[model samples]
Target: MNEKEILERAYLEAQKIVSENSFREFDTSLCENVDFLIDKIGSNKSIVSALATSLLKKITNPEQDIRLHRTDFENGYSARSLDTKVVTPFFKRHFPKYANKESAFLTLSTRERIKWNKNEGKNLKIRSKALKRSFLNVFEQIEDGNANPRVYLNYLFAKLQALSSKDELIFQLAKKQSGRSGVLNINLIIEMLQRHFAEKLSSRLPVVAIYSIYEILVPNLKRYDNKRLLPLQVHTSSDKHGFGDIEIYGDDGKPFEIIDIKHNISIDADLIFDIIKKTTTTSIDRYYILTTFPDGFETKEIEKAVNEFIIQTKTQKKIDIIANGIIPTLKYYLRFIDDYNLFIKKYTNNLVKDAKNSTEIKTFHIDKWIKILKEYKINNV
Candidate 1:
C-alpha cells in the first residue's frame, strides 16, 4: 500500500483500539478525518507527513475534552482516584529528565536532546524553541515512510514496561524498610489508581473496603460455580435496634448470604448480634464476619462468638469466620502501588524523550493507570 493508504489504515486502527479499550470517550474523529485526507492524497511521503502533522495539532490543541467523568455513586471511584494521585505526579515531574538523558545516552537515531542555556528573560523562549526543535526531529526520523510502524508502537509499549519495572524496584526497596516513606508510597499508589483507572474497573467503594470484600468473597466465589461477585454496602433497620450494618446479600446476589468487613482490633459480640437480629427477617442464607487485625488474633475468640450466635438464633443460616492479621496484606498492596508509581514515572519520561527528539510537539500516553489487586490469604476460623 502507498504512504497515504498506510497512514489512513493505521489511524483508523488506532481509533478503533482507543475507542474499544479507553476508559473514556474521546473525539477520535480528528484521527478519522486525517485518515480520510491521507487516503485522498494517494502515496506521497510529504502528504502523509502533512496528515500526521495535522493529526498531532488536533490532539495537542486541547480543543477536545478528553477528561473522563463518572457518577459519585459507583464503588470503583474512590480507589481509582486514590491510585491516580499516587502515580501521575511523580511521572510528570521526572519524565522529561529521564527521557532526554536516556536519548542522549543511547544515541538513538530518532531521539535528540537539545541543551538550553538560561538567561532571565530568554528562559521561556529558549525552552519553547528547544521543545519545537525536538518535536520535529523525532517526527522526521520516524516518518521516513521506511520505518516500521511497530517501531513507533514498540516505543510506547517499552515505556510502559519500564515504568512497571521501576515500580517493582521501589516496592522491593520499601519492603526492606519502614516508616512514613512506605506509608506515603502506598498512599500514592492508591491515589493514582483512583484518579485514573478506577472508573474503568468495577467497584465504586473505597479501594481498601472493596479489597476487604474481595479478599473474603474470592474463595467462596471460586468454590461456588466461579461466578463474578459484586460487593454491596447496605445499611438496614431492624425492629429492635433501629439501624446498623448487616449482611444483606451473597456473592451471587442471592438473598440468603450476608457478609460484613470490620477493621477493628476485636470483633464485638453485641455488634454481630445486632446485625444478625436486624437481618433476621430478611432472606439471609449465611452470615460471615470478616475482621482485619493489625496484629494477629486467636481464632477461638471468633469461633466462640459464631457458636454463640448460632445457638441463639437456632436459625438455619450458617455462620462463617474470617479473621487475620492484615499487616502482610497491607505490605503487599503497598508494594503494588509503589511499582505502579514507578511505572508511570518511567513512562512519562519516555514521552518526554519523544518530545525532545523532534521539532514537532506531540502528546501521547494519556491512558490512566489501573491496578488489579491480587488476593491474599484470609485466616478462616
Candidate 2:
C-alpha cells in the first residue's frame, strides 16, 4: 500500500480498538493492532503518528476526562501573580537580559516567534491581551487563506506532547506550581482537540460553521428536493472595515445582518454589547452572535442589553445571541473535511492526496464523520 493508505489503515485500526473499549481500560491492555501501529510511528506523518499514539493513550474520545477546555485561565491560575509579580520579577532580577525566556537562546521562525513573544509580557493580563491579539491575527490569516489553522494547531499539540514527554521533566515541575486552570492534568488530546482546535477555529467560526452546516444541509436537501445547492462565496467584506466576521446575505445577495461567532468557556458581556453597538451602523436585520458558551443568567443579560439598546437608540437592527452547543460538531466537520482539504490543497496536489475522491473516501472513511455525529452525544447541540 502507498504511504497514505498505510497511515490511514493504521490510524483506523487504532481508533477502532479505542472506540470499542472503555478508554480507562483501553490504556491497560493495548491491543496487538494498536501496538503495531504505535510501533510504526517513524513512517507516518506527524498528524497520523499523533492520532495513533492518542488512540493507545486513551486520548481520542472526549469521554475519557474533563472535556470542555478553555484557552486561558483569565488569571494565571494563581492569584499571587505567579506569572507577573513572581515569575517576571525573578527573571528581571537574575536573567535581566533574557527575561527568563527561552527566546534568549534558540531561534524561532519569524512567524512562530511573534506567537512566542505574545506569551511573555509585563503581566498575566498583558500576556493574555497579547495572546488574544496573536490568535486573532492567525485567525485572520486562516480566513484569508494565507495560513493553515491545522498546521498551527498541530504546533500547539506538539508542544503539549513535549511537555508530557519524559524528556521534559522541568515542565512537570512548572505545572505543579502553576495553578493554570487552562492546563489540566489530563490527556493531551483533550486539550489539543477540545480546547486549542475549538478556540482557534471559533475565531473564524462562522466560516467553518456555515460550511459544515451547508454540507450537512446539502445532502438532505438533495434527498428531499432532488436538487443540489451549489456552494457559493458565503462571506464577502462589505468594505475596508468588513461586516463583522460574517454577513447574512438577503435574497438579492446584499447583507441583511452582520453575523459573528464567539466560542468561549463563558460569554463576556462587554463583547456582546460591543457587537450590538457595531450593528447599529448597518441597515441589517440584526446582529447575530453564535457561541458555544453554556446557557446561563449572563446569556439572558446579553439579550436584555440588546433590548435596552433598541429602546435607547431605536436602531433598524437588533441583537440575537445563540449559545447552541453545535460549535464542537462544526469544529469536527472542519477537521475532517474543510481543514483536511485545506491541508492537502496547501501541501499536496491533484496527483497525490485527495480525501474527497472515490477510493480515498473508503480508505479514509470520510463519511464516518456522519457516524461520529450520530453515535456520539451530539444531542447537546
Candidate 3:
C-alpha cells in the first residue's frame, strides 16, 4: 500500500479503537504492538483526541512500569524483613495463647478473632494506598521533568514507531524517520505535506481533515471539459495558485478565488504577504483564508499587512482577505497548527544544507505544498 493509504489506515484504526474504548464499557488493549503508537495516534487532531490522550494515562509508561516493578522487588525485601523483625514479634505478644501454639488458631473468642481480622484487613488497605501514593509521586516527578533527565519520555515515541505490529503505517513512519524507506515520493506529493505526512499521527491527521474540507468547498472544478475530477493538481507555477490548499480557475480562463485552508488559528503579516505574492498575477476577486480556530485566531497581522501593501502600491486591485471562523464540519476535529516550528525546507526534494541554519528560516512556497496535495488526490484525473 501507499504511504497515504497506510497513514489513513493507521488513523482510522486508532480512531475506531478510541471510539470503542471511549465508553469505558468496551476498554481493551489495542492489538498494535507499537509501544506508544496507539497513544500518539489518539492524541490531538481528531474528534476523539481526548480518547488518545487518555490512552497514555491508561497504559503504564514503559519507564514507569520498569521502575514500579523494581520498587516492588526492593519493597519485597523490606517487607520480608519487616515480617521477621516487627510482625513476628508483635503477633507473638498479641496472641497470648500462642506462647506455645505455633499457629495461633488454638483459642480465642470468636468476636475477638473477627475484630483482629477486620483490623488486619484495614491496615493492609491503608498500606496499599500509601504504596500507590508513593509510586504516584514518582510518576508525577517524571511528568514534571524532575526525574532522571536521561530517562526521556520520547524514547517511547521511537520505540512505538519501531513496532513489530501487523499495521503497515507504523512501519512506514519508522521508515520515513529512518530515511531508509517510506513509500510517498515527495516528488509526487509536495514538500510541506511530505513533512506533515511523516509527523506522528496527532500531528499529521489535521492535513486529512483540511483535505476533506477542500473537497467540498468549490462545487465543480475540472482540468478538462469532458472529464470530471473530484481533485485536480494545478502546477505551483500556475496563475490559478490557491491562497491556501486549493485554487480553482473559472471556465472563462481567469482566476476566480483562492482558498487557503489553514490549521493555524491565526496568521501573521508575513504569511499574508506570502499568499499575496502568489496571487499577484491571478488578480483574483477574493481571497478566503479559512482557519480552524474559532476563538484564538487573530487576523490583525494580515489586516495590517494588507493595509500597508495597499497604501504603498497606490493601485486599486480590489483584493481583501476574509477569515472564515472555522470549517463547521471539522470544528470538532480542530487542530492547533503550530506555525512557529511547523515547517522544514527542502531543495530538489532533499534537505537544504547551508552553512547556517536553513531549518530556522521559513522559505518554502505554500502553493507548492497545495500542488503536491492536489497531485496526490488527483487519482482519477
Alpha carbon lDDT at 119, candidate 3? 24
Per residue, candidate 2 scores C-alpha lDDT tens digits across 295-376 of: 5225677657644654554333344444333344344434434323232122112111122111111211212222222233
The positional error of residue 88 in candidate 2, measured at the CA in angstroms, is: 38
Question: Per-model C-alpha lDDT, please?
Answer: 0.33, 0.33, 0.33
lDDT for model 1, on a 0 to 1 scale? Answer: 0.33
Per-residue lDDT value at 161 in model 2: 35
Model 1 agreement with the true structure over 71-133: per-residue lDDT tens digits: 233311221232133222222333321222111211221112222112211222223343333
Superposed Cα deviation of residue 370, candidate 3 (Å): 27
- Report the C-alpha lDDT of model 3 over 143-173, residue by residue, as the tens digit: 4434431222222222223321222333233
- TM-score per prediction, in order, is 0.26, 0.29, 0.28
Q: Which is the better candidate, 1 or 2, if ranked by lDDT?
A: 1
| Winning candidate number (TM-score) | 2
